[model samples]
Target: MKLENRRIWITGAASGIGEAMARQLSGVASLLIISDLNAERLLALKPELEKGITTVDALPFDLSNRTEVEKAADKVLATYGGVDLLINNGGISQRGLFYETTEEVDRRIMEINFFSYVVLTKKMLPPMLAQGFGHIAATSSMTGKFGFPLRSSYAASKHAVQGYFETVGLELYDRGIRVTVASPGRIRTNISVNALSGEGTRYGQMDPGQAGGMPAEKCAARYLRAIRRDQWEVYIGYNEILMIWFKRYLPWLFRKLALRVGKV
Candidate 1:
């Protein structure tokens, strides 16, 4: 399916891959609904994206807030009758060891990263089923397919995302409900800077690997191409993507390599 004139809803559109996607799809999209917890950022981004698009708007709400997510779902369903393409990209990263992190932090990460996507999918899927076609895309991580030292909770959340979507993709393939899970190894984003520490405080610094990873716009381009092909799964990033191969074929060596890599 061509992206031109498609109704696309993107979460975490204020920055990173989401922002790059909005930029790429601005003119091609018929209705672009961007959402983020920061309303001001969303409002500010609207004009920058609406010049060529038929319609562009922002719906700001904290994904971690259940009531807010439900209300946002209602508004989305009511507006477009159902989201033609749903992009689940809103999430936080972890930077602390599992032993040091609190349960509250784990819950917060899961709420935003995993359950919110499920909630929105449940809400938006009915309309897709009614219409006989819809797509759901998620920005998972390479960690979703492999294990690492830090980011236990974040990795767990992403793993859950993969499991859920993989099941959905298999079950709904015949129903015209397509699923694409993007596994990005590393990108030049502020995810590391905003990553949660052991006490749930911000890490507040960018990691060198992230600084040197693939650019966000390039990653976004790759992802859009995958979407065009309706790919079930695709990996984005530079050398980090190779880690998936090592994990699959060289589990013992991958474990050793994981221990050797720089933390954060």
Candidate 2:
């Protein structure tokens, strides 16, 4: 579980939580493969992160494109033998009412947030199994544990992530593969600003809650800590975590409070 000299691949590494993770992990990892749709940003990020530490490499691709992901996986495996850690962090967010959101929007969210993770994992899993040890981690959300207004599709996608990782952990742990699903509360990241609206447009604005939420660096630290400790799952952030308790122990209060939690 120790990350030092580990070969790690993090998706969405150009910015936000993925960037934070790349920074936090760079000094410790032997090879850090950072992937994103933004080739320029990833290239820009490389030297800053490398700075005489990890072997930082950028693989720019659209995660929604399964063909690209599969090819990328082939190259990655061929290059690194196999990654010791695969962090499934490449995804988008949602911020619109269910009724207002189009079917295409929902599909887009699922494709980017859910299916992309599945596709990349499928590509890398066999190598992990063959190599005899590996870890798969994912970023879920507080909403993944419950639900939220204006984020139904986002919540649904993360819910699927939470469920899938749990099942993977249970099914693969004995096979030399580990799984950790991080159900983070709101952390200051570009997710809200880039979140897809009902009409499939970027929200293009940061929510007040997000601006005041836990810092992305802090979230990344906690995520790495969870992986190091080999935890099956973890929840990061502050007050938003209370929502989980409320939903679990006080469903009525949770339902009422959920109504007033405002747009995330």
Runs in model 1 with CA error above 4 Å? 262-264
Sliding window of 10 residues with minimal summed lDDT for model 1: 255-264
For model 2, what is the C-alpha lDDT against the true structure? 0.91
Off by over 4 Å in 2: none
Candidate 1 per-residue lDDT, tens place, 1-264, comes to: 468898999999988989999889898989999999889989999998996755997999999999999999999888778778999998899999899999999999999999999999999999899999989998899999977888899999999999999999999999998899999999999999989998999999998889999999999999888888899999999988888999999988788788899444
Clashes of each: 0, 0
lDDT (Cα, tens digit) per residue for candidate 2, span 195-251: 999999999999888999999999999999999999999999998899999999999
**Residue 38's lDDT in candidate 2:** 98
Error of 2 at 95 (Å): 1.3
